[model samples]
Target: MELLDQYSLSWIIGLVVALSVTGVIAGLMAGLLGVGGGIVIVPVLYHLFTLLGIDESVKMHVAVGTSLATIIPTSLRSARAHANKGNLDSALLKSLAPSLLFGVLVGTLISGLVSGLVLSLVFGVIGLLVAANMAISKEPAALAETLPTGIVRHSIGTGIGGFSTLMGIGGGTLSVPVLTRCQVPMHRAVGTAAAIGIFISVPGALGFLINGWGVPERPPFSLGYVNLIGFALIVPMTLWTAPIGARIAHAINAGLLRQLFAVFLFITAVRMLYGVWA
Candidate 1:
């Protein structure tokens, strides 16, 4: 109520409607695709914030931080649905969590150091590679039955964390392919990626919040860089739709799913690329 007092009633209504729609889309995408909804949320929030007149300097931060916060519950819900079918690799999830959190913190720091357009470029490039890998690769996930250990695994986990954080996406966008490449099954990879989202989203969101604390020129009701209103509105919709996505993932053909997911990733990548100039 008080937050809306800063703007016209129409603007507040429009913002709420947009966030609601975003929640639905992100939630379903995360559930079906095992992502944290960051890819979708980041762009939507960035443009929406611009329209709402957020400070140019901080708009990207707010969008990213809020996306991370919103992904936490969405991913958890999706993870639960997948776990019910024993599709999750708990050990792999654990392996990725700690280093991933650290990487996300590192990424948050990197965010302040880099411009949004630069970050968008990086996001687009990585996402495009991920999309291509998923779409074309048909080799058996026969690299290693057991997960890798020591520095190699940790290093990769850290990289995933940092990249996802920088891109404001749940690490699944990166992790699923890596898991499959490491010989993890597709369903299992998707399930575990959902679990990984918790690690990335929670820490990444906190990093942004603390990182942006007392910073000037952010939207109202912001906790550091995280927008409270957007997170609240988006989380519920994501919560509702994520389970449905998990259901679809299980029900569909694996190849078909991969193709569809690849398309989604490709589009997201191109959109991010476009945003660099748009």
Candidate 2:
């Protein structure tokens, strides 16, 4: 009871409702598209923390870090669901993991050195580009008969790791496209992307932990950029909802889902960009 007094009833209730909704949506998208919901989660968190009067300087970091924390469990659940369907490319995942890890470390370190406003601007720009790419890109039918070897695979993995860490995503947005370009089947690409999220998040989250160490003026229940409260609110619900998303993905038309996702990305990007300049 005493501990409860620290929070306002209205704020607590709002947080619960908001986080619950976010988890459900994120899970649905992740399961359906094999992309972690960081694109949605990050902006929502940014706005929420702003409303809560968290210091502006650390708000973006908190949002990104907390989103990564949530991705850990959510991505694991998604990967498992896809794996059960025998869609994961285990060989490819193994080949790319090392490069991904190193890239995540570098990205995380760079994130700490940058300003929050700069990060927000960058996210906004990237969001726009992702939305544009998804909206206009034609669906390719060719499939990669063989997995990438040696230098090319490593280079791609590095890009996935670095971009994912910087954007607070699970790497699916880029990974799926790259895999598709390499001629991997759409479903296989989604499953492989889900697997990549786990690889990316482990080290990415660790980077946030190390980068934000001992920073003053951080919120309560925070470790560097991550807020434990937000993580606790999101992870369980995201994990439970992921498999459901996967099931829906199998049922839904892929073209429709992609269009819907693109629209959502556009809206999110516009909102974030508006906030950056406003």
Which candidate leads in TM-score?
Answer: 2
- Cα lDDT of model 1 by residue, 1-278, tens digit: 76567777887788788888888877777667555588778877866877778777788888888998988887787789889999998987787778888888889889877776777788789878877877885674456766689998999899999999988888887887788878788899889998888888888888889888999888777899888889899988877887887788788775777678789778867977887888
- Among residues 3 or more apart in sequence or in different chains, the pairs in candidate 1 whose N, CA or C atoms overlap within 3 Å are 32-245, 141-183
For candidate 1, the per-residue lDDT at 11 reads 79
Clashes of each: 2, 2
Q: 1-278 in candidate 2: lDDT tens per residue?
A: 64357667786677667767777777677678656688778877877778777788888888888788788887797789889999998988888899999888878988989977767877788888888776775765544555578897788888889878988889988888778878777788889888899988888888887788898666667887887777887787777787898888888786678778888888877777787789
lDDT comparing candidate 1 with the true structure? 0.81
Q: RMSD of each candidate?
A: 3.3, 3.1
What's the residue-level lDDT of 274 in candidate 2?
82
Model 2: number of clashes? Answer: 2
Candidate 1: where are CA atoms >4 Å away? 1-6, 32-34, 51-53, 134-146, 244-268, 274-278
Model 2 error, position 140 (Å)? 4.1
